[model samples]
Target chain A: MDNNIIRFTYNVDGTDFTSAGQASVMLKKNLRQLGISPDTIRRASIAMYEGEINMVIHADGGVAEIEVSEECITIMLKDSGPGIKDINQAMQEGFSTAPDDVRSLGFGAGMGLPNMKRYSDHMEIESELGVGTTITMKINI
Target chain B: MKITTVKELLEAKVVWGEELIGKHVYSACGSDMMSDVLAYVKDQSVLLTGLVNSQVIRTAEMMDMVCIVFVRSKVPNQEMIELAKESGIVLLATDKRLYDACGILYSNGLCGNGVRRG
Candidate 1:
């Protein structure tokens, strides 16, 4: 049988934390309708949700592309912001650059990237200081 | 345990999803940190937390949790309740503290979704 492929693009708004996880929520619904396994959907949604939040908190905004096929689901998030100066530092838990106000909102614990890495089967990050950041994550179905 | 049983066990007030009380939940997690919840990957259906905010509901939705229990007498506002309702997640509030509530559930056969570290 030929594999079914689906693709979706989301425009993330970084200024509003209230609307950050909308993309992931919608993607979860779409995946459920497509009959993906609950575990696969949860991992994909959680990884993408963390990426979405990072885009809003660190970057001004960003773009998310999700491609779903029989073999795997791929997510690419690109943001134009003050790129990560130290990738190692950013990856560490409890090391966050977020302002105190962001922490009050229940995020900015420096666990976003780490959670994304934990949930996805594979992950890649590309960034440049003052330029932008791009993260690619994939989960095998 | 069923969501209804949780409500009864904790003497929780139902904030939303009254219809979902009969739903079964095999595992649960209690935490104030959204990132910690995201870090642990499990098929847990219930979340018990003291943190009151929109992210709590968002995290539960992202994880596909069926219900949220607000511990320590924390009451969620309309916005948070609305978000939970939209996600079809049952919301409950209890006077019990986080540790006590988790213990009650654990003793009643609710397992935690263990954390994964590498």
Candidate 2:
């Protein structure tokens, strides 16, 4: 395996709804500049964007770490917010705990986790109710 | 369809990314829900949406969309415009509602290839 890897890290700001997807936008740009395939880049960006938005809306903020190897790109999003009580329920489409205000902004549609899973080649979630949640996703390049 | 044609069809005002006006896009999806857009859209270059928040632009960016149409006279804030400009995604606002705007474009050759099929 080629080991020419690149890494990126972004601190998601949970305080502002307007800035929710900024990290994903930046990652997309960097991937494009690196000449990644559009399909792979799109998949990774969508998955990462949903995760980033979830961090803001649910977890109050988080840290995103990205590692790009020749064969795949991996994202690790970890947040210190109240952990998910029911991971299975949260993964279901059309199920959301978001308030009406989030709906008003045209999100909280309960499609984030599903879309994240749909777009990534591999996904893993680890959470503790009182602790935090860490979601790992990978898209093979 | 060429983006210029999309602009003409919607009678929209280009808010930014004038240089991208001549680019072409094949399909479009109109939705206010960014989450749904992210989930359903596949290979769409144009997004027609009513939402005016910054995430609208970010959603487009995540999908690698080249253009966004804000239907129903919705206007984006400065932050949204800047984000679009940075991504080189053309932004347009049309007085036509989402349905009408989509209808015009669909009839003119931009079909619903990117939208989720029932």
Candidate 3:
């Protein structure tokens, strides 16, 4: 990691399903401009995208922070929604807390966390029942 | 297949990225479920869906897709169109239903990337 790395932040709004993936889009452009490989950009963007959607749907919106360095791209998502009761169950495919409305809009299939984990080199979830959840994912460039 | 060919074949209207008409795409997938599209990891560049939302454009953008065809007479709203333009994704709308639209493209050489399975 270099001291001169670029960092970006986004304030995700939860009220609009139509605006959920904005952070991922911006991050993709930033990575591309940084001369990261397309494969690396895709991995990081998709992981962050899923996390962004989760923040909007499950949490009442959140903040997304991206830190770019020589070694890896790290995305941190913090949300003040009801924390997951069981992280294990939430990680399962098809286990979603999103309502039927979200499914009709083309999401909430319960693959959010799984897809994030699949695309990133590492993922960590820290949550408290009533407090909130913070997810940190890193993809090595 | 060229995106222009897709537009002509489906009698579609372009909502954005007119300059991408000549771009080539080897594979495509049709689904309203963004998760399903994310599950399938392949070298796909076209997305056909009945779902009209900003997430659709975002999904295509993340997958590095060059074009998105909205089937079953679905039309994207202003926000979605703006997003697609900004992302440089070609957006097309067709009156053809999802199955028929996909069938036409498939029969004409656009192959599905095949969804992921556990």
TM-score of each: 0.94, 0.94, 0.93
DockQ of 2: 0.64
Please give, for residues A2-70, the per-residue lDDT of candidate 2 as tens digits.
458899999999999988988998898899999999989989999999999899999999999999998
How does model 3 score on DockQ? Answer: 0.66
lDDT digits (tens) for residues B63-113 of candidate 1: 778999999999999999889888899999999999999999999999996
Which runs in model 1 stand beyond 4 Å of their true positions? Answer: A1-5, B115-118
Give the per-residue lDDT of model 2 (tens digit) for B84-114.
Answer: 8888999999999999999999899898776
Q: B1-118, model 3: which lDDT tens digit per residue?
A: 8999999999999978888899998999988999889877677899999998788889998988889999988889998888888878899999999999999999999998655534
- lDDT of every predicted structure (CA atoms): 0.90, 0.90, 0.90
Determine the iRMS, in angstroms, of model 2: 2.6
The two-chain DockQ for each candidate, comma-separated, is 0.69, 0.64, 0.66
CAPRI docking class of candidate 1: medium
In order, the first chain's TM-score in every candidate is: 0.95, 0.96, 0.96
* Model 1, position B69: C-alpha lDDT score: 98
